[model samples]
Target chain A: MVTMQNYDNIEYLSETIRVCIKRRFGDDCEIANIALATLGGSNRTVLFNVVRGSYPLRLVLRQETVPSEYSPFLPSDMQYRVLEVVYEHGIPVPRPLFELEAADNLGQGYVVTAVPGETLPKRLINSAEYVTMRARFLQQSAEILAKLHTIDHVLVPGLSALQESSDPLGAQIALYDRYGEPHPAIEFAFRYLAKYEPEHGAKNFLHGDFRNGNMIVGTEGIRVLLDWECAHTGSVMEEIGWFCARSWRFGRVDLAAGGFGDRETFYRAYEKASGNLVDRESSRWWEIFGVMRWAIYNIMQSHGHLSRERRSPAFAACGRNTGIIEYDLLKIIAKEFD
Target chain B: MIWSARMFNDPPNASELLLTVREYIEQLLPDLERQDKYHGLCCTYLLDVVMRELEEPPNIGDHSNNALKALLNNKDELSETEFMSSLCASIRRGDQDGNLDRLLILLTSHVSKKVRVSNPDYLDTKDYL
Candidate 1:
């Protein structure tokens, strides 16, 4: 469970990674460089370059550093397996290279080949360099999501570990209640969603945390969907709802589809790609649920900081951000638009 | 006996002090490394929250609770936590279904008041209502 905060142990990390590389690429392979990536809250991501014979290979090592009992993520090994299955299905994902062995003493994690792209939402949506990408990501992501949902869950072994919620709304409410911090807005949302719960659709393989910030965008379009930690089996609309949540829109509230384009364009593309009709009413219901889910997620993160499970200024700020998200949730549920 | 009071102090009040520190951090942010800079930005943002909270009246939460009480038709006085917790429980139990409109207004106001301090930038304050 060692985090990047203890970079003083770089020598130990270097040796371990060197051993890992040597095992895969012969003893002549040498670790050229390793640096800790600053993103992600639950996992430690180390970017490293290896010289295998005369070839230079770039790869990323992702480890579950701080495990939360309340976390909804699948185990690290499961995420790796999910990556493997998705990559094999011709999905645009980083190639899963190898996993950390128990004897490695670095906790559970795996390595993947690094792909070149930007994951920052603000830059991708607003920067002139990404104007073409901004126009294309909505359609591309829709197609990817549609194809992803069609994947056979049975193809991925041990997917039983993923929670297949019969009552997704109720399960989320249970998680919200566990934190025991009452927000009238979130509570009101819980009531609203329950009263108008849509008929459940056929369960599909969903990328649980699919959204703007979780995607890798290149100049052409979405390079890959990242963060399979929240992958689960649920209603397909759950993924769409999460994508259109106002929180994921960053600052561009108008472009609700991951702040890329209008929901109409995204929904139409998904229909064409998946050959399934888009249910607008059901999607909107999930959108409200998505907002409430995100607000509760903030509380969980802040609790992580307060309880000393792990402390970071970013996590502490999430406590106050919950109020802002609550404002958005109330607005959406009330349909109060400008 | 009255405690000695100074007409002026060497430093300013809480809000002004926080503003000064936040400005210093913003200026120092560019020189820090990537991770340190991100943390610095978060620190400055938290300081902004503290400054805004200091600017608000200390009894803002009590006012919000009173609004909730009136909307819920409760006459008894209750602490902020008690009011919010009970209201939340009632909503979950569907006891407040008939009063969704009134409850929505009250809840929106309640959340907006907090956002005004937590981060007013999130709201179009000119016409948040």
Candidate 2:
């Protein structure tokens, strides 16, 4: 229920944030330019610059918003822990600074060093500066995911406590049914998936929301794989297939690997990095499942707007916008039958 | 008898009215701030959808009902909502596993018709139809 007005009082936030930073970096720290981030829709992101003696630091503060219907079980502190583990293991993740104390009055949230790069899909795919980077996009994504999947759940604290589902298709069906809304396209897709469920592979760490928009692209390649809120212990193919999902392509349907490269190139890179064979059939199955999941998510987002929990034009448009996804789902599923 | 019925009571239909409002908002967009401009663009897009709906109403209800009846192989006179719910339940129970070929055809046609109303450009770009 945090309105836009709650963030307007910069003075109150600056005072509270200053105390949190002082506790972390000593009493000589000063916080400035704390304002809302423009990009994310689910959480409240505040970017600020901190000065401690002669050193200047750029950091981001992420706060939890009112829980939407699709919000994952991983809280901000749990995500901070996951980031800590990922960063320590040489993954390109923003360094976790610290979690806010109860006295900070910022509700539930944490801070991380702000990595400088572009996360917008349009710029990453079409911009002149990223032309060369686009060539290595798929390979780099594969390498990162391969490395991420190798992380030990026991070593990474609190990761095992996060939900794990062996039957992802069943879980998705239960979720759709719980929504109490009938989507014929989604039901049809789910039925298709159920009848052709792929063989389950070994469970591994999954970057739940690994896609074009979730990544921060730099001149070299992916600077950081962001948004670990959906991270879970699942099949490696699920992560690979989620990346190749058409919805994540963002209108550049020609390039299947997040609009960067073909599916073969992506699969090859992943195999090279993980030392495991990639099954095309399994990946395709997950891709179809990913599309259906996204369509359901769109419906949930529109409901959020309709129920007045969150009011934004973007959310309101999702209900009708599902048509395009439905079309894509039918096309992919039909090809399998053929 | 012909003169008794009034013709052209309103010159502009619902579609025309929506177009006029959308045009006015587009004109005022340049003066608005960044956030307001984005919201104005969304409003314009919504109005465009409304105009499309008015010009050619989508036949989703009829199409869905027909698809459901074909899947169940029954001609029960059920409401669109009820029929879809029953079909979904049947699908969840794996009733369509043996007849996937038929279900696939029905689903494809159903979604294609939906895209025609919501975003026909999808079909044109993919060359699906």
Candidate 3:
């Protein structure tokens, strides 16, 4: 595995990609236009083009730069397998390419065919250019999620390792305990979710972080879903609740459905598409779960910075951001808490 | 107390210093590459956090501490982190279920004060706040 220090050497990175491309395709394979993507925080995302014979492929190489033992994200190979399975099922995800093997010495990661579109939530919501996307976003997102939840978890063998289906709330509580940062609001929400655990909901394949920023939005809306590292088998409503969580809404709190439209519209579209009844009460429970998960994410990033595992200003901000998220979580669960 | 604090600290106080650096980064952002620009934005956000903290220190004063103290009756000597941690254990153990209504209020108030320091704009939820 290549250390991140050497990972930053563009010449070395380009050579590594070239070798991987040659190994996957043939000696004639030519890799070009390799550039690092600027958006994501945890992964080192690179955009490049590869050509062999008459075929041209624009690809994304997502490398796990900040590896942590206590992290909740699935291993890189598992994430790749999930993407392959989802793509095979006709989900609108990027086409998975070859995984970087141990021999490649570039560390753990994989390549996928890049999809075109803007992913920034603020721009997608506020821009006039995205008016069409905004109009179609709710229906499109709901339809995609509906399709995603319909996929058989048996198709992805790696998913069986995840225990989220058996006890989703317990799995999250265990994750929070592993992080070991205590928050009264998170503790309260944990109890609330445990006490009011939804009695009925089919366990379905979920895009564990299906929200605005994780999808690509063009004029049509939702070109492809990205980030399958958090994929798990869990209650279908968990996916819905995560999508509608206020943290993912950016500044458009009014538009609960990923800052694109109303929750009612999204729920109706999803219900119509998935053939599953929209459980509003259960959805509220999952929404609280989603908010607590967001707060836990903040703590994880903050700990990463504080513990000197991977220090950055962005991560340091997450420490304070946890407090902001806690306020949101408490407000949402206040009625039930009382 | 006789002299202005600004005179001893020099012209650029902590807030002004952060503001100047943040302004410089903002001006330099356009020229940087996309990756560098993203980092520059993160730097600006961190600087803003510092400025906010300097302008409005965390309002977990005696009143808030007392609220936390009241919740964990035996932990009068505990610091804020200890108090919160103890409260978390109590909540997890269901020992605080009877007092949840009161606990919720205290936790909400404390987190609200935190929000005021971290990002006050978040508290301006038009629908809820």
Candidate 4:
């Protein structure tokens, strides 16, 4: 097992919570437990409750993997843009409690915020509760997405300043080429992308990872849309197709959209709220993009576990997922070709 | 042998769970020639995660593309085949050079790019272990 010591020390973590809490709350409060969830996060996140006087304030530690601070969280500026805007729009997302302009007591640069709600590892997608509420949930999500897309750039200065992907298609080809680098399967996908490029030129918001799993849902509707780390302004339908991607179908293969809801349900809800017809061809093209994207991820990630620094059943297992992307792509393309 | 919580608790530990399922998979696993049970799990999980990721590869980023463009600076715009060969070559070079971080960065970059160009939102880091 990769030990926690290899990354950062507890003292650093403790100090981060203390400083951030103090910055947000006050100097007198005592932050305890300071438990960090290292696994399954884009950045380091910790759960802690602050004690002051007679009561305790519970909070979450959110570390934005700033490119300036670290290597992995590339496109840091974009992440900050999404986080700030989503939080501002009154969308149910983690409140933007803090931003790390400079590395504080915490060894790494991060942002801390209010913990939204309980997150369940076992998804509600396959649960009986989700059966009837499927359409309602989807409509709610689409309505929320509509509000997000209409987010006025003037409110968040950063998003307005952020540049659109200049050569999204060429850039994608180059990017995927790098990902599939050294892997023949990836190369094949690259070849597929080269000859059959889709129409680009989309200007709208893209919540890169908008899916059922990322959402923090409970007794009420979705408490908050979590994980804005990958948010950007790209093909807006990217979000729609992503929500409908087959990987999320869980075990309910019939529900193509997150494996429980139909596409029509999702689209109707989106169009109804956004007052914009989701271009079917654009959505179709993005769906193809979805498959190619999945294939690239599997090939590169699997190749990592296939390499030396990584050797866990998990990594090995992760690498194995590449073929599923290939299959999704084949299925998507076959239909288009026919 | 009967299952025991002493060692195997609710949602039995992955290793233990693997052992339990392996027992059942053994009947089918043995019929296949040359592939050991361990490799079968490896290959199967590899396929599983890959398939899951194919649903959504991690989003490709801007600067990462800049990095790839930087690495292949001198060469002519590379064909997909050339890109793969070069990537494989770079990975091999990384192995020979003893650069762990560079190799990881390369792998990460490639996956990011692949998802960007192909499925866009199909695969994500979550699908991987």
Candidate 5:
């Protein structure tokens, strides 16, 4: 992991500004401190808190490429730009403040956006403040999600550059195929998603990872969709399904939508806001896909540790859980499908 | 009776042993892609670990698969659901550290005889990996 000190170079900060922000905002701002968040992601998020007198400014800094010592797949500038476009459509994200290439004002590539709410996964919905406002959270989240999917898939931009498969079912099955073995756990999920593929008929917006972890849970129970890096154009059910995925329940499995409330509550909220029918069966199909998708993501991060360049036991030890996830999926599949 | 290589000086996290033990062989990734077949399995191993770790008490799974061994013992008697349910109940019953230590010890015994050789009669809650 590149330490925070390494990023404190004054020359680099000036260069980063020149390339991405200064061209737009000019050089009147002064950086107060450079800080990093070492959290659940593979990127180095250096926050530049600049002193613009009374009105302080915060810029989120991430590099297109990171040293080999870190995870190699830190999203590139291209990936960051794609996310910016997603944010532009008002996707409950910190609007893309700036995008830059190497220049004297900023080092390498940098992008900055005002920080959103504190990124808290564990406390958000569980906090007493969210209980009474629970229904609003679900309704607003589904409404925002509906808007995200309703956007013209073509205009969303960066679809081709991101990962895609021949068809929705094919993409899902191929994902499972990558992990061989007829283990009852994975097979159960595989059969269900394949057998009962959501017949949504037309593709729509998909927030590939929409759950408690990605969302910002706040006062109004508002869930600002975060992390468009994994966003894709797919069945609208895909996003909803992810919201209700078992893994995302975070122990409160009873409240399906990020464990905040039940499916009826979520469904009513979504349908009322989006003016769409609740596709219960299709949601089930996507929910199954959500678990599989999460499993794949987990395995990939764990696997990356093996590369000498990015070797960290912390990463590698995480790899040993496919079977367990598969086990959960299989049980769910058997219970519902068989 | 044996001291070799950098012994106690090593901070456990940064050791070469870390590289070998963790399944993510990103270094070996290139080799597997070239060899052509096992690459998928190799990759799957790492992904499983990453996803689970991201969830909670992350390191619990890999070092000790011993928690549910009793379920495995009655493999003939236990259906998949029954086994899983029982194990899940057992895991939820107490402190995670105690459970993890017990499981790790069991795994150490099963995977290697070194623990047995060093202390055959050792059996106590206090012992830890």
Candidate 6:
């Protein structure tokens, strides 16, 4: 509901947001410290301090950005609904407050209580403050993902069975084709995957972008899992593979589990949590698929910059990262073959 | 002065110039904040890649074609790009199902060549294979 005129001014938007909060929490609520949150690339997140009566609250307002070709087709409302369901199910997600009303004159999105922690992967891995948690990071992450996968898909509104469940390799090829440019390396990976398609497993909730950078970590452990926009119904192994993907390791290829621990430690923790045996072969296949997916996404990000859909030096650098991902993909596949 | 057409050998080659710029940016990176720092780091990395490309351009085409030729066991008039595209198509069509090993070898060789140019460090650290 953001009008064209007031949309560009943060101060005006803050006052308007104050009015909306006043409507919800009565006129006793006061909003202040309206500042932008740093990490979200696809959405605009605003952090604000809310004083309601005698209590103070830290909250986040996530507003959907203008959709581009790269934006996931899933609605922002769907994400909010998913967050609500996940939080209800004891998941470590920010507590969902409420979705914005059209009458509020703010753009589409919702409000949630902000989790107190950091999401920066470099800091999480290297900072002295997080040293105590690093040893248990892999097991903690695995446990969270295992719990997430156990959530009944029927419980989440707007959640649908993944099309990839039927033909995992073909779906990726089709997606790449949709991008309208032929990448010989990616095409080669696709063919390789198709030729050696892994045995299908039971479908579950796949946290499509599960990685260290998306998790908010504190001294205790993982505070909350963030970025649920890519959530979908697929193989549980898909989430595992994605979490262990080389790119997610953040340059520490030595530590397989998001640069925190070895693959066995992560797999063992997940198996223990979910009561499901880990299929090493199938998991490895999905790992390769994860790398390829990341490579394709890097290209898409670069294309966004190159095509002027979004002009960012980071996107251009992401395009170059496709090479490193391809290198890892080849290395992993070759090692598997041997 | 002899009137002869010739290409000049420049003192500051493309790689050298890119390295200089990358170094300068790397020095200034400490001053940047938040988004600017992130973008500055990316720019520095991009320059590094461009420098690497100039110094050691990948010949993946030749490596891929050679591998493909061996796998197909036939010498044809198809260009390298055409052959690669056709190979991908054939694999997609399940024509290579019977020869998965050969396909793996070809792909590994091609991708390895690319890695050599894109990031030789990957090859150096990856001793698993």
Evaluated with DockQ, which candidate comes out highest? Answer: 1
Residue clash pairs of candidate 3 = none
Model 3 interface root-mean-square deviation: 1.5
List candidate 6 stretches off by more than 4 Å. A1-34, A38-41, A51-56, A66-73, A101-106, A162-167, A336-338, B1-24, B57-87, B96-106, B112-118, B125-129
TM-score of chain A of each: 0.93, 0.91, 0.93, 0.81, 0.80, 0.90
Q: Is candidate 1 or candidate 4 better by TM-score?
A: 1
The positional error of residue A219 in candidate 2, measured at the CA in angstroms, is 2.0
**Per-residue lDDT of model 5, residues B1-129, tens digit only:** 112233466454232344455445655455653222234344544444333233333233333333444524544566545654454444334322344434433433332222222222331222223
Where is the poorest 10-residue window by lDDT in model 5 chain B? Answer: B111-120
lDDT of each: 0.81, 0.77, 0.80, 0.57, 0.55, 0.74
Q: Per-residue lDDT for A1-338 in model 3, tens only?
A: 46776767788989988988888788988988888775244567888889877887899999886574676787788888889888998898889887888878888899889998898888888888986677588888888889988888888786856756677777778878977676888898888778788775567888899988888877866799988888888888888888888888778888888888888889999999988888988887888888898898888888878977656677888898998888888888775321
Q: Model 3: C-alpha RMSD to truth? A: 3.1
Q: Tell me how far the alpha carbon of residue B82 in candidate 3 is from the true structure, in angstroms, after superposition.
A: 2.1
Residues A1-338, candidate 2: write the lDDT tens digits. Answer: 43444554677667767887877788878998776565244566778889977878999988766463456446777777888888999999889988877876777889999988898787888889986787698889999989998998666566555444456776677666666887778988877787788887677877688999998878988889888877777788888899999898777888888888889999999999999989898888999989988887777767767877666777777887887787788888876311
Q: For all the predictions, what are the DockQ values? A: 0.77, 0.56, 0.69, 0.10, 0.04, 0.39
Query: TM-score of predicted model 5?
Result: 0.63
Report the lDDT tens digits of candidate 4 across residue range B1-129. 222224445765544455566556656666754324445656544443344333442343546545655554536677657765765555434322343334335445455454443333454554222
TM-score of 1: 0.92
- Candidate 5 i-RMS: 14.2
- lDDT tens per residue, model 6, A143-169: 888888888877765566444545566
TM-score for the first chain in candidate 2 comes to 0.91
| Model 6 collision count | 0
Docking class of 3: medium
Measured on C-alpha atoms, candidate 5 has an lDDT of 0.55
Order the candidates by lDDT, highest first — what do you get? 1, 3, 2, 6, 4, 5
lDDT tens digits by residue: candidate 4, A1-338: 22334334667667756776777678888988766553332455667888999788666656543223322233444465567777777777766555554535443434545555544423466556655556666777898888888876445444433332334444444545554445633344444444455565545666667877777766456778877665546667777877777666665656766654788888888999999888766676666666666655555444544553333454455544564555455545545211
